[model samples]
Target: MPKLKIAASLLAGEFINLERDVKEIEKAGIDLIHLDVMDGHYVPEITFGRQIISTVMKLTKLPIDIHLAVTNIDHTINGFMQLHPRCIFIHPETSYMPIRLLENIAQAEVLPGIAVNPTYPIDSAKNLLEYYGGVCDVLFMSVEPGYGGQPIMHKRLQIAKNLRPFVRGSMWIDGGINPNWAIEAKKNGVDGVVSGTYVFNDVQPMKLNVDSLRGESLSWRTP
Candidate 1:
């Protein structure tokens, strides 16, 4: 198993104090900065556009994992590619040409990732996953997209267990990920997790907040 990587999800960060939050997360030993890019058409929320995401890219030295929670990935992908993020995660259900999009992302020298929602089981994407081969990675949403502060839905994880064989490289789990749930995620074959609210809390030391995600049983102070 690969060493667990923790990504601080900016969807849960304080937007007004983004730079400070980015610095704090990096200081906490975060491996990646997970940026959730939601287009209102796909998910109800509308996160910032290219300028904000570009600003976030400049804020941290850590890699950026941009989750494209939009209905049309093909149309807007080039915009994200221009920013040169470390990786771009797109949902198979949303793409008109998922393989082509993944190919485009890979050709752009960025890791192309496929994000599976809790409602859509990974098993169902087996053919696409298999066909894509080395072109993309996997990201399982332990909770629903669009919103934050959801708990890990164990039943959904159970539903997604069947497609573990198709993972080509890294696998990341997002949404409702905290210390305790991360343990369950690891068991389900996740190499990284996008933890937001728990990690960006105002109560604990940044390092403690990060280390706690490594499966420690510390009481989280609410932000």
Candidate 2:
């Protein structure tokens, strides 16, 4: 397998010093920047909106990846599209017309993907994978409601195996991604890991924290 790419989520960074945090991530050679747009109704937390994401885009040279965890997918999506994000992942559960929304994202020239919740069935998404997934740059599997150092729920690794056959692009796991979990992810065919707390919630320099995630290896045996 190729090296694991790390998409660091800036939400977990110190928002008061946002510019400095962005600069730190850029210097760390982080491969991608992951942003979450959440409405209180959808995921219980209201994260920032479009303008903030646009600001984040301005602060970095890295590619921006977005997860749409909002209820108003139709009204809010266009604002993000205008920013030309690297990839936009819409939870298939949120849209009544998910296929159409995914198509709209493609029309705007952004890579479109489905973000499967940990409990959502892959069987239900096979067709979605067959269609939009083929052209997508990555399949973003959220395997964490997990923290940075806890043992990965082995079941989560199973999801990667289930997704391995059809995903043409890379498979990325979001949440609770540490090096040990990353080794197991590679064994299961996962190509990238997304982390917010792991990258930002530390006294370690951002370079040490961010670099720790991307260049993971399985050379040593992992049980």
Candidate 3:
């Protein structure tokens, strides 16, 4: 089994002190920084654009896993690739030509991935996952795409288990990914997790939460 990694979502970080939060997460050994690039037309929310992604690039050297939840696939793809994200994920439902876009991303030497919503049929994306030397990966959504802080759709976990054998690349789960859910995802062949509120929550220190999500023993720091 591949190692399970924790990707801390920047969407749930402190906007006022974004750089600081990113640095702290880097110190805590986060595997990647999950950036949600949302366009208001596709998803109800508007989030990071090229500008914010550029600034984040300066903040940390960690690999960036950009999730593009936008309608204009060509335009959005053209814009974000300039920043050279480690992995670029697009929602197939929003794209008119998802396979082409995935191929384009691979041709550019950037990792390509598809984001499958809760209702998208798993088999619908099977061919794309096998395309272009199997560079295409997957981001399985456990909740709706537009917003955060939603509960994990437990049913989706089974999909990951069922598709694990067919996926040549990584499989990740997003939304409501706490320590317990992270464990469950791993059991279901998920290679990584995108955690927002749970990772950045204040009740427990971020490092402790990150470690716990990896199934390490919890260590406390008394105030």
Candidate 4:
């Protein structure tokens, strides 16, 4: 099995000093930077836009994965494509034709990803399997979309496991991932773990917490 990677979601980071926070997270050895873009219609929250993402882009060389949690998939898709992020993940619920949108994202030279919320059954995304099973670059399973620090829903993990066979690229677990759950997700065949609160809770230094989480993930011996 491949080693599990960690992506630090910036939603829980210090919003007051985002540039500083990105530097801190990069220093902490996060593999990828996860950005959540919410439009308040899909998840009842409004987050930063391309400007913030552009600012973050100037700060780090790490690959950025932008998760679009908006109701207007077409507008969001067009808006973010201009920013040239490393990867783009759009919720299937929001997109009228997710498979086709995924193709458009791929044509734009950015990795395309399909995101499914915790409440949606894994089978609900089956239409994508036939069309994009091997084509999409990533599959993000969200326990919750808008905010950070939510609890990991065990059912979501099971859903990820169920979808692993069909997912050809990488399988990412988003939402509520911390040191404790990272190991569990890894053991169950998750390719990457997306963490927000666990890395930037302000309860401890962000770097220290990330280091500890990485160590915990490394220590787990899969059976």
- Stretches > 4 Å off in candidate 3: 131-133, 218-223
Local accuracy of candidate 4 as per-residue lDDT tens digits, 1-223? 5556888888877788998888888888888999998888888888878899998998999999998888879756887887889889888878788878888888888888888777766677766766675566545555667777677787766767777777767888888777767777877778888887777766666666766665543432211
Task: Score candidate 2 by lDDT.
Answer: 0.74
lDDT of 3 by residue, 12-103 (tens): 98878998999889888889999999889888999898888999988888999899988878766887877888999988877788778888
Local accuracy by lDDT, each model:
0.81, 0.74, 0.84, 0.78
Q: Model 1 over residues 112-131: C-alpha lDDT tens digits?
A: 98888877755567788888
Off by over 4 Å in 4: 216-223
In candidate 1, position 160 carries an lDDT of 50
List the candidate 2 regions with Cα displacement exceeding 4 Å: 137-152, 215-223
Q: Against the true structure, whose TM-score is highest? A: 3
Per-prediction TM-score, please? 0.93, 0.88, 0.94, 0.90
In candidate 2, where is summed lDDT lowest over 10 consecutive residues? 214-223
Clashing pairs in 3: none
Candidate 2 — which pairs collide? Answer: none
Better of 1 and 2 by TM-score: 1
How many clashing pairs per prediction, in order?
0, 0, 0, 0
Candidate 4 collision pairs = none
